[model samples]
Target: MHRRALLAALLCASVPAVALAVPAPPRRVVSLGGSVTEIVYDLGQGGRLVGDDLSSLYPEAATRLPRVGYYRAAPVEGILALRPDLVLASENAGPPQALERLASLGLTVRRVSDAPSVDSLYRRVEQVAEVLGVPQAGETLAARLRAEIDTARAIPAPRHRALLLVNRSGQFQAAGRDTAANALLGLAGQDNALAAQRGYKPLSAEGLAALAPEMIVITSASLQAVGGMAALRASPGVADTPAARAGRIVPMDDLLALGLGPRLALAIRELKKAAQ
Candidate 1:
């Protein structure tokens, strides 16, 4: 072959090999956690989502998608039926057996951490974006989220000691130091009364009294479960607490309040407003 023709032939051969080596981005994705789904939507990759879990209830439109079930108990059959090219899950999104079984199916299952901190949240966003082949979008979202969080944190620290409670049928469970609720309280500049406790635990009348929270944060679902704010205040143990007595109760959406996702900054802002 002529020198120029040989060079062109070599270039064409290399191009085909390079193209064949690159994997196509996942087009049909499944989100196995609420925060995972929220991050995807925030990154403007919602169009690629084919299915999600029960916990993926943000953005309203996510609810319209087919559900594979709750993250922890997600059934392999339901998920495989969706024919997902990729599945993004939270760190705690499965039983060990289920995840092991899933790995055998020759599909990509990415588990992002659910750590309750601003840094971890940003990392999770980046991880999802990388998987979706949109690293730039992820970077933009992370920067915006950081700025919003900083703005919320600029508010003067509240003097009140607050306890976040999850009330289910009048039974109160307090969110402790390691939880997303505690992280939110810290961002809002309120002292978490249950910070000494490691994780969520049921609070007795004595426990509540010792904590002596001046304000109480409750979820909208929990508040409604016990028949609203009035009913929550009237509940035996809660009524005796300073928060209930002083009418210092704040209610927020369950996912937005507890989930460490795109809504985290908003959650902090809402908590700050309610604290004030």
Candidate 2:
């Protein structure tokens, strides 16, 4: 079996059967991840959200809630202050100590895995909804998301090598295999130009030139960091790339590109269009 499939199966089997039978749905909830927050809203339980991590910027109203801090560095005190009956977080959420502290305080903290793939995304939505006592909503949302993603995945593949990168000052950070960006690129029918690598890492001028990607995908935030699209093309090392010459730079909102949330299908479609 595929590694992700094995992990998903193990994750599903590990859930306690009795937990699915919680007597009362949590009325006060704190979300500690962007995708977790989006799933809550998609489940139609946004009103229950009393707080969220800084990453929860989608759906606008989520921004009005008190922030507990960044997902990885959340403070237990801020979360406790929200008086939440339940906390929905990404598995990657936390400095272990803070989450341990929160758990010790007698709070129910449910963690959804952060692995970003169509299967993982479905699992995350289901996990969040189930913990919120809305399993049926989760099922429906997951089904819809799966269908939409399948449709997006059906688009004709563009036979082009594309590199998704983040530029900081003129240096580049490129996405590699097994990352959210790489998964989304495949879903959008573009081959990851940096798939030879395993994760994100700095891309030197020589490295970027060697990759010779036909297209470059970047986030709006990264574009701003290197002085916008025009400046990006003019930057040293990047100026020589075929992608820069062809103006094949695709810039998307960083959140949408990385969140792997409810809007993932939309992101995939947009990227596919850009690649084509």
Please provide, for model 1 over 32-97, each residue's C-alpha lDDT reduced to its tens digit, 9 standing for 90 to 100: 889999999999999999999987879998999999999989899898999988888898898867
Q: Candidate 1: where is the Cα deviation over 4 Å?
A: 1-4, 168-170
Residues 144-254, candidate 2: write the lDDT tens digits: 998998888787756678898986565789999888899888878888989988988799888887888888889888998987888889876678888888888899987
Question: All candidates' lDDT scores?
Answer: 0.86, 0.86
Find the candidate with the highest TM-score and give its number. 1
TM-score of each: 0.94, 0.88
Q: What is the lDDT of residue 152 in candidate 2?
A: 82
Q: What is the lDDT, from 0 to 100, of the residue 58 in candidate 2?
A: 86
